[model samples]
Target: MKNEVITIDLGSNSFRVLKYDYLNFKIIDEYHQVTGLADGLIDSGIISFEALNRVVEALCIAKDKLNFNPNNAVCVTTAAMRKAKNSNEALEYIVKNSGAKFKIIDAEEEARLTLLAIKYALKREKIDTQNFTLLDIGGGSTELTISFEDKIYTKSFDFGIVTMTQKALKDGKLFEDLRNQEIVIKEFLATLDFSIKDFPFIATAGTPTTIASIKLGYSYFNYDKNVVNGTILDIEDLENSLKLLKEKSLEELVALVGKGRVEYLEIGTYIYKLFFNVLEKSKSIVLDDGLREGVAIDYALSLK
Candidate 1:
């Protein structure tokens, strides 16, 4: 078990802990909790006491489940912590209550770690990794990464499903907001002075994977990551999935994608659709691997 390592990806919406047997190159155990650490963070510049408690409780639960030393685990917090005004105090509280030491990584480092995971995943899937655009949608930010031979470029946007939904609902401009975001991203790309057309598009994270699950006719209760990985999602299929998601009520949405995710799926799908159109990609491969996997990969690399 000395070769086993733990990676905690404390995201804006979800908190995940993975026990990886790096020697065998496989995940031995994993824990996922929808802590919603970024919930209500848009209006309040600080992490609320309730949100902090939720994260701490989840961390404690994951610690017991995996029985890993908190000091040994590589735990990384993303956008929520980065934007929180009281992040230091929040970290102190989490460590005191749960013994989980977490680090807040910048967007650039976040994208780099995520790229490591995506690259490993693509190689495992027998897909070409020389050229591809990766879309990683989180709760507080979305990262669009373009990877070419020995060079990778990434731009992180502030609006993710959680923050986007909060702002749009507060302003009553969901459609307009989505359109504005799409325009902003396109403009940012234009400034890069390079074309992204013809690059293989790959998306990792909850939204695309959830849509793939629905397309495969698997409910939240029966979701299978193995089948979900490497799934190809065409633009037409995404549109259809959006329509289908919109038709479902909150209860039905929960039945399909789980509780913590129901409210944001529709908006997430809208963002996914916008990115596909912006990238001029008709189809994209969806992968379930993400930050947690990337952290594990980096830790394993460090040992070597």
Candidate 2:
């Protein structure tokens, strides 16, 4: 009989439950909720009570969604958990309430696991994995992985949508008169020698995929994997999306970007534009699968 495993990915912005069939090597079911688990982690250096409760509530929803009892599930926390000053306390609270043991993974391991998701998805799509770069922008960090000339290289950027937004545009405005922000991005990009233009670019994770979905006019949370995965997103789409988003109020933005994702969507767009602009090629392939899928894949492989 095929073994079933549930992977609960505790992300900075959302909590996701993925039911993976190890024997089939595929995700059979998935659930997502934005609990803002890292909302104030950057400033306070601890997981806020609100964030903790949000996670707990999301966990309850996930637990009830599955056919099997959720006690069999394996929960894991990412960058947000690592940054919290009281991570141990936060995790203990989670276990006490959720009946799930959460594992905190390191940065390098996180990057490596993200690669697994891309590799698996690309293989399924029959796309060329020979020479490409993956830009994974999450809530708390971005993972950049490049495969050039048969060698794979990876590095993680500590800043993500939330951290970058809070740092640069905390005024709760989108793309203000800050010509200075471009210089910041440019300087940060300069530290990395890889050319985005030379290789096939693949953007994974919430921010990129969300931007891609929005451009495609997919209703919020109505994302279709077939329509989204391996789809090309134009640089112009980022510009137009940002322009449209800049015009909306918080309530309206939530309706458009989906609840719980509005906070970082604007910042996500700017970050998207920053990376998309660097590519000599004007478009990028969007992959819906990312760290969560990677975690499932890694776990499945370990059992082999």
Candidate 3:
């Protein structure tokens, strides 16, 4: 028998599990499910039962796929679980029902892990230390990490696709009015001293990769080949996708893409547009891997 490490990433919009074989240093199995854990948390600060049940079911399914014992697994929840008012309750429920203990990772750790994963996946030994920024946009939060010549500065913002969409709806911001939200986003980025031209950007998470997949003409997302260490996105293609997606209804968007992602697909598209517009950057390197891979790398590093 071989030792394997199970990494479970309980995200705001999805639940993912990855099993890595220690001996081979390779990912053996991966699973994902859309749970939308942050669906209504923007206004209420509490995760709804519907969302909770969905996530729990996803976890149970992931657990069943584990070839190793549950006790050997390490589970962690990110933005969605962290922001929920009843986070402890939700955490307890997962532990009690799923027999999976989860550690709620903080923003700083999230940023650090994201950087680690980028380094590992890209194998960029000599990153342009002078001017480089890494962005990981999740369902409930977005993390920004600015790397200068010698140091890394990081911050986690509450604005994410799901949370942003909920806020926009609550405030009656028209779904089509992406330009109107620029002021709010500009202010948010200003707090971090982020300027679009300050550095080249690297983006992680589903939106960037999905956009990359669309650019490559992938009818269905191919995570392994299309996403991981994927090529940079073309700005014009991204703009075109955003334009096309905006004109779509919920059903239409899902039909074009797939089911379960319609709820946040439009918002995610908007976010991609907003981020690129703010940075004034025409393109970004899309990283298919994010926090879960980061967590695994962090765990591996700790052993050394």
Q: What are the lDDT scores of the predictions, listed in order? A: 0.89, 0.78, 0.74
Indicate which candidate wins on lDDT. Answer: 1
Model 3 per-residue lDDT tens digits across residues 152-211: 777787678888878877886745446755665666568765454757788888777766
Q: Across residues 49-130, which tens digit of lDDT does each residue of candidate 2 receive?
A: 8888888888888777865455677777788888888999999998888777898988777778888888899999889657
* Model 1 CA deviation exceeding 4 Å by range: none
lDDT of 1 by residue, 15-108 (tens): 9899998887788999898899988998998888999999988888888888988877889999999999999999999898877889999999
How are the candidates ranked when ordered by lDDT, highest leading? 1, 2, 3
Q: Give the TM-score (vs. native) of candidate 1.
A: 0.96
lDDT of 3 at 91: 81
Worst 10 residues of 1 by lDDT: 187-196
Task: Report the number of backbone clashes for model 1.
Answer: 0
Alpha-carbon TM-score of each model against the true structure? 0.96, 0.89, 0.86
Q: Give candidate 3's whole-model lDDT.
A: 0.74
- Measured by TM-score, the strongest candidate is 1
Check candidate 1 and list the clashing pairs: none
